[model samples]
Target: MATDLRVSLTDRCNLRCTYCMPEAGLQWLAKPDLLTDDEVVRLVRIAVTQLGVTEVRFTGGEPLLRPGLPGVLERCAALRPRPRISLTTNGIGLHRTAKTLRTAGLDRVNVSLDTLRPEVFRTLTRRDRHRDVLEGLAAAHAAGLTPVKVNTVLMPGLNADEAPELLAWALDLGYQLRFIEQMPLDAQHGWRREELVTAEDILRRLGERFTLTPEGSARRGSAPAERWLVDGGPGTVGVIASVTRPFCRACDRTRLTADGQVRNCLFAREETDLRTALRSGEPDEALADLWRAAMWGKKASPDLDAPAFVQPDRPMSAIGG
Candidate 1:
């Protein structure tokens, strides 16, 4: 059963992160083609009421780019057995919107921060919004977004050496930091297995600074990050390890693009067009059936380790990472 749904609010992003997109010439979806606030609410209602979805995460090229996001959060909060609402963002705009989003019933947030150094941040993202991201982290904590996670994608020669420093910074500020193994979702399609910084390498580096203990088998089902206690303290750090250690067996999440397509997996080659069905006056129960059937046919796992593994056509930004 698909108990979680990642809803892409828009495909328009402000930053040109190296892994997500090129610096320019990106084609964005037209306003009319994207789902309206009411349409998103309707699909979410069906997912929660019929399909037993208990969590809904708002993702995007940048979800904060959507003007009506707070209203969408409010509507999702009104549902019976209100699902947990979260957002995955770049944190560039959170400084201005975090309080409003929290007040509108957002439960938590995960912000993407790849590096702490200003120069490296500029090199990776092609933007100088490092100070803005730091402020956004502070604002999120002030707004009471518990467990404000910082997601850092570890590149082999870039920012990989800062693993311990990044964890210490997050720990000092009472935030959870997760180092993600780079997957083949870049716009350039230049990813290679040898370039990945594995979880074992990260743990080893982190262990040199802090006393760490694995939180083995206590992780929540379907949760992507494997956690570790930091120095027997309150803070914890996580490693996604997507490339080295695939977690597809217990995956229970599905995705809804801003254009209304249903994606069963992040790496799925095919998508079901739910927007057309929704616009064609299909009954709510029928739409629910379509969603369930789509997820039911999902493959046991995405073959990321196969020698013939091919990168998906859409990059991470378009896929709502």
Candidate 2:
């Protein structure tokens, strides 16, 4: 059963990350097409009350961009057997809203920070908001958002060499760092396996700097990240090797786009339009049935290595990475 749900609060982003969306002048979804705060809350309620969802992760081009975010968090927190709420953001505007979000019952956050170097940050994200991200991290920590995770996408000949530096930086700030293998979700759809930095390479490089050991089975469950103990100590690091080591078998999460489409997998080419049903006056149980049936029919695993593997029509931004 799908126990986790990722909801894309919005499809608009401030930064144009190279790995995601590099070009400008991209057309965004119409405001009216996006789900309202009530619609999102209703969906979460159905998932929690009917579908056995225990975790709800809010994602977006940047989730913080949604003005009604805190209210949405509040509504989700009110659900019976209240689901654990988390968010994934770029950290650009987090500095101003982290505390508010936390107060609104947000449990944790995962911020995308590829590099510490300002020049490289600008080059990778097409924006010079490195300072903002740093400030956001500090603010999140200060707000008592424990286990603030930093997600770094590994790219060959780019930020790959900064693994040690990035780990140290995160460790210094008492934050967990996770390196993710680049997937085929780029807006440009130019993903190539040759350009990816595998988890094996990441472990080799980080192992040289720190004494690392694989995490126990307790910590290595359905999570995509293969966790490791840093120096056999308190802190940990993880690698979501989606390309090198796909974890589709244990995948228990489904995604709902801001435009109200239900996706069973990140790389899924097919999507069920829930907005039509919801707008057509479908009852809550019926909506939940749609979700359950959709997930039940999900592929056993995404064929990322297939010769005919085609990128999804929607990019990472629109798909709620």
Candidate 3:
């Protein structure tokens, strides 16, 4: 059974990355439509205590935008067989909230930062908060969020040339670096296969500047990233080639959206509703059953290379990636 649960606290975000959403932003979920703090905690309790979830990752368009984040972490920490908690954020307000979150049981963080250039950041995100993200990363590291990961997506004509530069920066700062191949989860549905920068392209670019020996698949299990040792030593970098080197067969995650819908896969078009049952006063057992049913019905991973492939209607922001 899947033990890692990705829970979205909210659909709200401060930055408007070109790949994520329109500049005007998406239709925000209504207040009542979102699960209350108590409701969120209760569902987490059920997932951990009843359904075998061991790790909970808080994700969002940017999870830092959630006001009750620290409180949510505190409650989840109080659970028996306490889970390993982490957050995936844009690193905008993390500088202010890192210590509070660490105190509330968060173990680590993954910050999305595609480029090191301030101008490139503004161009990509349509926001001028690049320095804020850098500061937030520093603060997160100082606050003891070890293995602070940086997720970078290389857009063909944008930051693709900076792959080696990005890796060197991460290595210098003691941050774990991961380069992800841009998938078809963008809102505009403008992703063309021909424009994609494949995993080979990334590795070849980095190879010119550094020696990256494969860490091998013996320890890879359900994790998505394929690791490589930098200079054949302690420091390492990862590449998540979701399209070219899909690891969906080994995926061990179940996703819960901010609105309490259970998603079986990131690309799944269907979601099972737990919010309705949750608000209707259904027992914890009933909620767990619904979740179980959802996972049981998960479809096989999509073959992106096939002619039949169709992107999900929900973008990464809506799906909480």
Candidate 4:
């Protein structure tokens, strides 16, 4: 299995970051409405065994919100061939959980950090504890999750000006940094086309300070970021241009929502209700075949790169970042 599986631990978050939770507060998915631990494990197994999945990423409103997240990661590690297990989070509660999570066999983590300015971070994430997130990054590093990746969403007039400094800081802190384009995933969250920081513009700006060596063309399979390393900077930097330079043609991954719906594409409006199918007694084989169907339906090119395609209704955060 070479595909990647994203398992949303919960639709709960501690920080209502502007780009993610726009309503000032989030409505949590009901306990019964969200997938159980067993359900997630079964779906992951099927994804690996049937879909030839090679990597599994745990995400969420904040993955650490899920009770016993480390245990879930351990179970995923126990899978045969041992798919590369990682997690993506906002780094709010990770300071205390990093050590245990790493010992449980979680291989990597991507912490979301947008601005270096404390006041700006507060405005961008709607929180004032920017220092806490920095401390969390320090703890994550201390926990020995080598090369922890940092995710930065660039929205012009917001955190866009902080890119160079953020990259420099991440390099100094020994973390991989990724700048993601602002997709029209949500409006109240401040996603607008004019406000977007395109990949070309970002690269040009960064190129002024550092030389980016081509990591060569991305090989098909499970990489979302088009990887790059600074010529002399500390760690690596990657760019995920879902809107500007969509790599949809090479997108081999699919998402399983917190509600147990499997979406063939992040830009998909409709999803197959796997929870209902599972409740109806669909065999594991059928469930696996359903995944195959989802992959087969993947667009040859991403909507951002295509002339026209179905625009998804849900926001990116709702799809597990």
Q: Write one digit per residue (lDDT tens) for candidate 1, span 200-265.
A: 899988888899988876564678999888988678988898777898887889999999989999
> What number of backbone clashes does candidate 1 have, counting pairs of residues 3 or more apart or in separate chains?
0
Name the candidate, 1 or 4, with the larger TM-score value.
1
Residue pair clashes in candidate 4: 1-52, 1-53, 2-52
Candidate 2 residue-wise lDDT, 1-321, digit = tens: 789999999989999998888578678999989999999999999999999999999999899999999999998998899999999999988899989999999999999999989999988988889999999999999998878999998777778899998998889889999999989998888888777788999999998899998887576888989998898878899999987789898888999999999999999999998999999999998999899899988976767767877889899999997
> In model 2, what lDDT does residue 242 have?
88
Candidates in order, TM-scores: namely: 0.97, 0.98, 0.98, 0.92
Each candidate: how many clashes?
0, 0, 0, 3
Error of 1 at 134 (Å): 0.4
User: What TM-score does candidate 3 get on C-alpha atoms?
Assistant: 0.98
lDDT by candidate, in order shown: 0.90, 0.91, 0.92, 0.78
* Model 1 bad stretches (over 4 Å): none
Encode model 4's per-residue lDDT on 1-321: one tens digit a residue.
238778777777777677666755445667888888888888898888768888899987788878878777888889997899888988887788889999999888899888888888888777777887888888889998767999898777877777788878888878889988877666254455666788888888788888887575744234778776698433568898888777765666778888898887777767878887777789999888776776676555555544464446666666776
Highest lDDT against the true fold, candidate: 3
